[model samples]
Target: MIFKMAWKNIWRNKVRTLIILISIVLGIWAGTFILAYAFGLIEQRVNDAIGYEVSHLQIHQPDYLLDNDPQFVIKKSTDLLNTIKKDERVKAASQRTLVHAMLATASNNAGAKTMGIEPQGENTVTQIASCIVDGEYLEDSDKNKILIGKKLAEKLKLKIRSKIVLTFQDTDKNIVSAAFRVKGVFSTYNAGLEQSTIYALKKDLDRLLNLKQEAHEIAILLQGADLVTDFTQEQKSKFAALSIRTWSEIVPELALMTNSLDQYLVIFLLIILLALSFGIINVMLMAVLERVREIGMLMAIGMSKLRLFFMVVLETCLVFCLAAPLGLLLAFGVITYLQNTGLDLSSAYGESYGALGFRTIIYPQLQAVYYLRIMLMVAVTAILASIYPAYTALRLEPVEAIRKI
Candidate 1:
């Protein structure tokens, strides 16, 4: 009967109830959006760091991973690649041989790292096809076709179909010369990769390095992030001679970015929760003060103080039960809209960090567990914040409160 009366009493002051409800709604919105946006930014960083630089996993000669030497090449046959492809967990795999060299012209020259990759295979391993900003990606038919970075092209005065000469030292400690026609020029958001790297058909590197049947590394693309660790471990156990590295391991900086983002989000959420708790406590206290005389009368009329306390607490639960769903609904609407039309942070982050190594587009994602936790915390905090006000109301004296009112 006290619970029923407390709930009915809450609606008597519609304005105050609305104020408290709106506060909760606004708090939920703020917390949800901030957490989602931060996670989105970190996710973009991870994808670009992984896709533009390292594929999900890279299989390298143990010596090459430990000691940076051109001689450390994967001498295995195509059978190994075939075996990996047959694994259901593997989406795509490609071979690459990376070398550092000077690409030059008569009036312009620049030092750049070159990657040799099979065009089709690379497309499978990386989003290579989508990254073609100008002209076209590498074509196997063109024996000497090259894809140069936009920044490198500018520095070396290169254009599509323009001839560029590359000079590099082979594994045998011999200088090799190769001329390639720039088939495409790509602009990446990462300035470092754009200024220092180039790509050519795998056959070109094989011919240049005089290694007809060897590759330096194998890159694998996985379907999703969850399976990367397990797959990397499985591959390492199977291929002991090869060193396997996941994207997170290959680029520890990205891991740091993710961790920092998560930490910031945790702190941000805590602050918002604290603000909400204060709002709930204030509202409950005001309501309790307003009803002190009625509470004291009920306690004097044979109603136990404990029952009066539970009544006030029940009133808070009632308010929360009514407001929480509305807040969650509002949050869901806003998040869904923003997720479809992403908030652009490109203007601040710049086009590329250093070179053609990272992409700029970001997509927002929220896990089911994130929503569950927020909902649970909001409900629990509301219930807990009412306790002090409930205790205060129960302690009031019947004669004093009634006479004062």
Candidate 2:
């Protein structure tokens, strides 16, 4: 009975009711889309870090973990590689021989973290082939070919087929130098990584280091994201001597930022709702003030003060109910579309975003669970916004309200 009365009262002033409704709808729609964009940027940064800098899991000797000494090799790495590949949960596995080397071009010299990798295995695990912008990816048949980053190539004044010399400490702590020709140039969103990393064939590095079937790191990619913790724990038991760590352990800052983003989401939503609540409160107060005589007539006819309060509150709730779904649905459709065909900001901002550690192309996505939370928050906001107007209705005397023309 109260709901039916409230519904009829709402339509009595169609223009006013619609004005509030549209405000709520637009507020929620804009808020949700902005949140989705924020999440997309954070997710993209984490994905890029995992895809390019580190795999899902890594194994290294205890000494190597302490200092990354070239002498501390994972013995019988070929056997470990076979064992890792046999795990059903592993999507791809690759061993890499890492060295901190001085790369000298005819024009300049720079420090680089050179990763010597198996061409096929590394391509499967890291998907570096997709980033190749110039020349071609490394080949097993090419003994002395190297892959360089675009930024690094620019700094070193290097190009495809350019010869460069690399000097680094080998297994015996002896300095060794090698000359290799650039096979490709690649680009990544990480400016720091782009300027400091290079790649070559694992067999070539192993020969230069005077070691056979030994590597500094074994990186693994899992079939599913949920499998990372369990797989890492399981591998710890098998290779107790070696230090096995997940991507989180390798890059703690990324995990920290990811965890912090949820708190940020809540904070931003609260601010948006708080701003909307003020407008809602003013509209509801006016609605109550405008119908004082009718409310007094109801009170005189033995309608309880509590029931009058509830009726006014229900009116606000109805407005929210009419608007919330429309807003959520509109935001969801737009966000979903953007997720498939990304929002490219590159043309407007150029690649300068990479210098700030962000990708220009963003694919906005929000988990389904967040939509439910947004609905819950909106309901709470509606209830809170109705408070002041409901109180105003309770304060009016029946005789005084009836006298008001």
Candidate 3:
């Protein structure tokens, strides 16, 4: 009986009730979609970082990156790389030698982290082969051939077959300058990498440095990302001489964003819900105020205060029940459709986003558990919003309310 009364009471002021319901619905839908968009952006960035920039794990000499010294080459690197590649968990592995060098053209010079690589191994791990926008990929058969990034080519005013010089310090602290012809120009989503990095054949570079079969770094890609932590730990014990770090260690900022994403999104949703709750509370209060005389009549007819409070609380719950499910369903449908179609910011913001190492085409997504969590939050908000109005009804004096209005 009380449920029927509560249901009827909420609809008594249909226009006002609708205003609050619609407000809650829009708030929830907008909030959820925003979360999905943010999630998609981060997820894409992480995948690209792992796939294109850094692999699942990287092995480096203990002090090699501190100053990019070619002298700090990994001991027996070829054996280490060959052995590690045989692991069933390892999808691919590659060795690279690094040098802090200057890339120079006749009219320009810029600082560069020049990488010495084996073409086929590099293609497997970093997929640099696929990023070539001009010319062809590096060829193992060719000596003194180079791959330069697009931005670097633009900065240096370079093109295919352009002759450039790489100057750096060798292991003996002696200055070494070598000339190479640009074989290919590639572009990466990371603009910073484009301007600061270049690649040459290890066979050619190692001869210049007078090192045989030595590498400064070994990049390993795992069959599954989830194996990173365990593989890193296992390798650490196996090769305590080398520094084995996961992607998170190499890119702390990206890892931090991924780890804290959920907490931040939940807080953001709470702020939106809080704003919607205020409007809901005001509408609920108005409903109670206008029904003062009706409430008094019910109390005078021996309706207990507890029942009155419960009835008002039920009205608030019913209002939420009417709106939140529809909003959640609508949001879920939109998210599902967009996850495939994606929101392409390529037209307006592709360059800007790619410069920051992010993909411009974002596919919004949310874990299924988050939807349940949002539903619980809405229910809690509804109950909390009902308290003041239910308490006001309880405080009403039956005789005064009946006589006054």
TM-score of each: 0.87, 0.95, 0.96
Ranking by lDDT: 3, 2, 1
Candidates in order have lDDT scores of 0.80, 0.90, 0.91
In model 3, pairs of residues that clash are none
Q: Report how far off residue 351 is in candidate 1 (Å).
A: 4.0
Worst 10 residues of 2 by lDDT: 348-357
Model 3, span 35-106: residue lDDT tens:
899999999999888887789999999888787778999988899999999999999999988888888899
lDDT of 2 by residue, 5-99 (tens): 98988888899888888888888998898889989988998777778878898999989988878989999998999999998999999999999
Global lDDT of model 2: 0.90
Clashes of each: 11, 0, 0
Off by over 4 Å in 2: 349-352
